[model samples]
Target: MTTLAGKTVVVTGVSKGIGAAVAAAMVAAGARVIGHYGRDRAGAETAVAGAADGQATLISADFHDMAAVDAFWDDCRAAAGGRIDTLVNNAGIMRQTGGIPDPIEDWDAVWSETMTVNVHAPARLLRHAVRDWLDAGKGGSIIGIGSWAATRGTSNPRAIAYAASKAAITAATKTVARNYADRGILAYVIAPGVVRTQMSVDSAEAVGGEAAVTAGLPMGEWVPPEDIGALCAFLAEGRARHLTGSTIDLNGAAYIR
Candidate 1:
């Protein structure tokens, strides 16, 4: 029975998958949500449609573009009525064709795209959120969506860049928690092993197949995105401030460490 009533949460990548689920969960907790979608307006709309009017607002931004990332923060603040209680960094990209065996140029392109969308974009957004909270002298919460690939290397050789980007962001998230906890600003990382998102399914296909991936998992099923959504909502409540700087893993015991 976590309550986020009267809170404002900003969730990026609200178009689909974990982002959409997080937005829905936040709305369900009675928090006003400022949701960011890359390009899928319809998906974004569907995610928050369950909320009462004025409970959610959707903004579109291409995270690959730094300017858009900046604009997104401005727009998100405006949508939240100038105050955001929580920031959820959920948008990310995993290039499925960037292994060392690939052509040099292709590898470079994949790494660049993956890092820009996954690491750089979230870093920029974190900066904006932290600075704004400092200026307002109010505490805020950060929920960074990370991956198990960050801790245990991904089996998919093509996703080396993806793993690297996630690890980088995880470190950055911990840094934030260490530096800002005394100010009441809390930061956490959610490292999911293999959620049932399309992204994971696609990655499975690239490695071997869905069957192979599932067999390797301790649980016979993929981690549901709803679980992630629920955890995001719980963290947004800021109930467990001591959990700040912790990386909560939701891999169904597949890659526990």
Candidate 2:
């Protein structure tokens, strides 16, 4: 069985969705987790409550706000206790008015918000993780939570900003993977589509419903968060570390490229 026993992993956006599932899965696999959340204290606490004994810690930060984002890394550094084995960049946002197709000021604000939280925040956190790994002289991995939209544009033009932000960050992740592999820092991207999370369900509803979302896919079902969580656990083990710059698409056969 794959295991991360005695390792320390940082998973952001653990208040819910795939982030929460990853945190729980890593803790279950015997790794200590620092689960980051935005505002949901109870949800954050709940995400790690089932962790093995005391293997999880909940950290809070609003990725939308730069000040809080910076301070969060400070606190995460302290929580690392000098060594960090892995980091899962999972926190992201997609406003209903996310794109700037409309030249209006309101659409511009939405576009900015999506990029700030989805791309810029993760970049800041990645810098800190890379620095720590370099300082400790230990090999570690980074798991970036991307989306299928990063590779294939979404049907909803309103989410163009969200798609663009993810694509940019995924490319950055690949670059880091290639450039830093010799330095023992690895990066990988998992781009998923139509995940069975609250956000996905809400988005499906906005368009039609669960059935509408599933019917569009060949599998006729949504990819569960636990599946992504399990995949993350496997990659975090470093067994397939050579696949650092690869992008694993988990779209339930909705989009193949």
Candidate 3:
């Protein structure tokens, strides 16, 4: 219902999972999408092929690398054919390892990669893309994909670094919103609970059966990627202008705040 016709949206991590679903949803809404992938060119090309006419373009960049991150913005700018109207910071890393006798290298890798993709890269991209738009007195929307771990303490011991990284994202969202609100650039965070992605399924299996884990949810099921995609679509539209600086939870009653 929220039409994004003529608008250009850049979604990172679009090779698969929620990123791919969000890109598809945006294309369905009539928005021209720039699907950003690190090394999954084949997957990104296939995704674009499945989209509507002139709906999606595949862009490649490694968020963990600063040089690649800069070049990515340039590529996105060029692909958008002008300014980027919507920026979806969806690329993130989740490692399930750590706690007592935790390996220092594992912690470093998780923390570093998480901060780079989930925090630093998004922050930098926003600074580059939104600054001129804001300066020129044009408004835009920025959505950061956060995790429910940012709120509740995870029982899964291996998720400490990931959780911490997401919390930082939520904080960055608020800061960006405050700093850019007057310029009409809004920022928001979508923190989803355990979704039925392959990663979640694997984690669930490691602890127990997927059904058993999902039964704990008040909704009695894991949140689907499409559901999150819908919310992201809404936030990317100008209709949610008043909802800036907020972190909306999509946990389906699991870890309700």
Tens-digit lDDT track of model 3 for 91-195: 877777754347888777777777787788888887876775866679888899888888885656777777888898789778989988988889999988888
TM-score of each: 0.99, 0.95, 0.93
Top model by lDDT, which number? Answer: 1
Assess each prediction's global lDDT (C-alpha) against the native: 0.93, 0.87, 0.81
lDDT of 2 by residue, 37-128 (tens): 98898888887887866678788888988888889878877877867889999999877764445657858787778889999999988888
- Model 1 Cα lDDT, one tens digit per residue, 77-130: 888789999999999988789799999999989998998999999999999999
- Least lDDT summed over 10 consecutive residues: which range in candidate 1? 72-81
Where is the poorest 10-residue window by lDDT in model 2? 97-106
Please tell me which model should have the higher TM-score, number 2 or number 3: 2
Residue runs of model 2 more than 4 Å from their true location after superposition? 100-103
Count of clashing pairs, candidate 2? 0
